[model samples]
Target: MYDESVVPVKMESFSGVAAKSPISQCIKTVLGRARVEKRLTIGLLPAIQYLSKNTNGALFCLTAAAPPGDSATHMQEVLLQAFCAENDIYVIKVDSEQKLKKLLGFSETRMDFSCILVHYPYTDPFSDSQEFDTSVLSEAENDLIEHCETNWDYAQMPVIKLPEK
Candidate 1:
């Protein structure tokens, strides 16, 4: 997880000639400038922070641990992206390898991948805000968890036995 403070507020207008959408530019700006951290975000701490700060968004991260050359991780990313698309959410690929290691408490030898849903906090403009709707976010999170569980549970492992000399 990174510092929410550094994430620039959503742009009100984008008139650049570049082909990227405003949301893309916003995500790039945030990821490029936000401060990195050494703590794990397993409990969706970032999402909670966004809610508390009233940043008008929520963040959801999907971290997958896989063996070398496994395609499950890639498939999960695709599925998640589609899910985000259907929910009118913006998904960003988080490629901070060092930060991810700290976030997942893994050694450099492990292969992991992550994607984050940039702030999705919902608020009322006319009145004080209450709890944000996290149903879509929760569904996405549950899908990731279920995918990992299924893959890990069915994965084959080699067994070694001591020689009976």
Candidate 2:
């Protein structure tokens, strides 16, 4: 299995904490409880995992291209969906950050979700494909946990830079 150590981390919280705090740790502990076997608490993981592996009868979210015959969305969705076909472990996707960015935004759930398979669709070099598995990401995750080094040390985690072809 991929290193889960990537997700659990301790970030520095600015308020409501003593000089020695583990805001990130609190978030990670709580999130680990919420997550399912390699799945996030939300409904999207199944979707992403299915798409990543190109599962037959692949059910997709709102892609940039094709939509249902009755649905009137965009046109470039099919060509857009094949990018992260290998990272799918769940059958549905929720575009985690967007929903959280608005719903929770500055809430505690953000750090907890640090280990989730984040989708970087509109990033540098690429624009619209998903991005997954990163090193700096793992570092950030580590910063979100409570115990600090013992729980989120670099030695415990291995980073995988997914192919960007």
lDDT of each: 0.36, 0.30
Clashing pairs in 1: 57-119, 57-120, 57-121, 58-119, 58-120, 58-121
Candidate 2 RMSD computed on C-alpha atoms after optimal superposition onto the true structure: 15.7
Candidate 2's C-alpha runs over 4 A off are 1-41, 44-51, 54-116, 120-122, 127-142, 145-165
> Each model's TM-score?
0.33, 0.22
What are the per-residue Cα lDDT tens digits for candidate 1 across 1-165? 523323222222222233222322333333333223221223233433433454334343333333358687556555654554444333333334445445333435444334333443334546565555555333333332232233333333111111111
Tell me the lDDT of model 1 at 25. Answer: 32
Per-residue lDDT of 118 in model 2: 25
Clashes of each: 6, 34
